[model samples]
Target: MVRIKFFLFSILFLCSSEILAQTENIKGKIIASGDLVGIHIINKTAGKFTITNDFGEFEIPAKLNDTILVSGVEYVPKEIIVDDISMQAKQLVINLEVNLNVLDEVVVGKILTGDLMTDIENSEAKREMNFYDLGIPGYTGPRKTQSERRLYEAQSGGGLVPLNPLINWITGRTKRLKEQIEREEIGIAINEAKAKYAKVIFEDEPFSETLQNEYFYFCGDDPSFKTLSDVGNELVMLQFLKEKLEAFKIHLEKK
Candidate 1:
């Protein structure tokens, strides 16, 4: 009886540890103009999610290096990592760039009267210059921040991260900051991947939302996963997903 009771206690302790791991809450605010309410804030690593109130402020459970995804319809999606500084501070502040759709500038090739009928008339048809005409491939990928580009190059094994010799022993500060940025990039990339590949990848074996969230967290833990995601190479990511799917299945079996 004593042995069985000790075993149960150990199980409870382990469970408690995991619960605590995801409960280190971080207070934050969205530093963007316009509507901030209903902005979704998700702790992707922990599978925890929340939304901002009317004040553009949110509190979500997160730990150091955990990825936090911030998304809204009106603003460009952003990811933040819970680095040591953010964890230690009272709150984290994120500045999000609002997504803008600017139409191409139009100039009248002919004089036009301020009349509705004339405006409704079809304009001249001119072939716009494009990459096809130039024989150059077009890039339609998401824009990368400076840190993100560095991280991508690092992952590709050709990046040289230069640091001042004086600050060489950075008390793990540099590493922690880098991790925060890395996690942010990874979270955004993973979000895009889930949207694009979720249906196709899980056709054989569908998973519930909770299970899927856990599976994504497992994938983000992989070192090379972020690199492939950054490149946005469809074939490479598909293969990566297949490999991770098998690994995830094996993990579930072990559990």
Candidate 2:
């Protein structure tokens, strides 16, 4: 029995070590002007991802031949294939090209007058043709909020182009947008938990408003809080909060 246990431990250790050795973090920077923060960096081959900091720097694990794709809202998507040299150096510097909107020559039309009344009377203000005009069915889902829309814009769009990038990158706008959305979710979860468990949980250990706020913030700080809150299951959230309460009580006792 002892021999079997030892052998099993050895196997586990070897597997752990192998996983640890499989990848090393490759630091990289996104070279661009404007908001470089929150650019998405994905390792296509390794299935890893990270975001650029305010300085347009990011790190993601990769080995040789692993593809890194970088995308931005106003930049063209570029792919980097990890080479032996880059792997050895464990760093990358990437340049980005702006995807500028090149407008076609505008057709000469009636110029607008300075007077609003004159412009309204003489000029046409017809709306542009849209999907509805073409009789095409469009998205009927709920409209996305500002943060959601910004997140979508950051992660998507570079127009039709070659996307052989070993990895895909997103603009920095995504990072900030996600945080905003996350805060909203956490706020909702905290409010719901407070309403549901208020007196019941604290009856055994009464806490002042300050302590209560701290306790809830403590719960919010847990990484798993976002997952639980997103799930939005009453029973699951309740159990998770109860577990957090015990942990919080223990933490307070230590202090």
Candidate 3:
């Protein structure tokens, strides 16, 4: 009887320990422009998911075979599956590529505009310097108007058919007229990202805070970002796209 009781106690203790053991966690960071921008961790079976802090770090209970979705403003969303590679919960980096053509319009005549610049500036505007503040590479001019000036200056080396001059002769810098094709390409890239993801962050109403906290780091303040504050749900994404395009319009408008 003593032996049987001891055996039963041992079995119960083992069972309890198994039941109380903590689950393993998944950890990782989201990357953009070659730096951590967001954090993503999920344990759907446990009904838990946590976003990292501003520094882009997070840890959450997880297990083998779980799935995690990582996303951010203007980036491609990625789904991660746990395996031997992910089971260790190693620091993971995710890169999101921008979507190029959402509207199916490949027309290259669109021009860059100041309004687009203003809008893009607003998206993550804050009080800190950003990659842009470092100034665009291979382009030089006054700081305030530097980006503005780069918009119109013909390619300095003049090897690739002089994009600015070709655009100048074609579009002639009118508001209604489509401007430079190069500027349009940049505008489309920016607008496409904004149209697809801005609503996911700004107008979703339920998930606005999730977007602001999890994805966008405060870069600096711009009227463009502020313009999105009161935007309605149906139009929020469109507004973001339009604003970005307006910024692109600057390429044709300047000089």
**Most accurate candidate by TM-score:** 2
Misplaced by over 4 Å in model 2 are 1-143, 162-171
Position 101, candidate 2: lDDT: 51
lDDT of 3 at 254: 66
* Ranking of all candidate structures by their TM-score, best first: 2, 1, 3
Q: What's the distance in Å from true for residue 63, model 2? A: 54
lDDT of all predictions, in order shown?
A: 0.66, 0.67, 0.45
The deviation in Å at residue 8 for candidate 3 is 22
Which stretches of model 1 miss by more than 4 angstroms?
Answer: 1-171
Off by over 4 Å in 3: 1-22, 34-42, 104-255
Single out the weakest 10-residue window by summed lDDT for candidate 2: 112-121
* Per-residue alpha-carbon lDDT of candidate 3 for residues 1-255, written as tens digits (9 for 90 to 100): 999999999999997655443347656665555334333333333434455566777676555655555544444445566665665545455555553446755545332221222222332212222236667565423253334445445323275566656665556542223334434434444444444445324432443444433222221123444334322222343445444444434533663
Lowest lDDT block of 10, candidate 1: 116-125
Clashing pairs in 2: 37-172, 38-172, 39-172, 40-170, 69-167, 69-168, 69-169, 71-169
- Model 2: per-residue lDDT, tens digit, 182-229? 887788778766765565457557699889888888998898887876
lDDT of 1 at 35: 91
Please give the ranking of all candidate structures by lDDT, highest first, separated by commas: 2, 1, 3
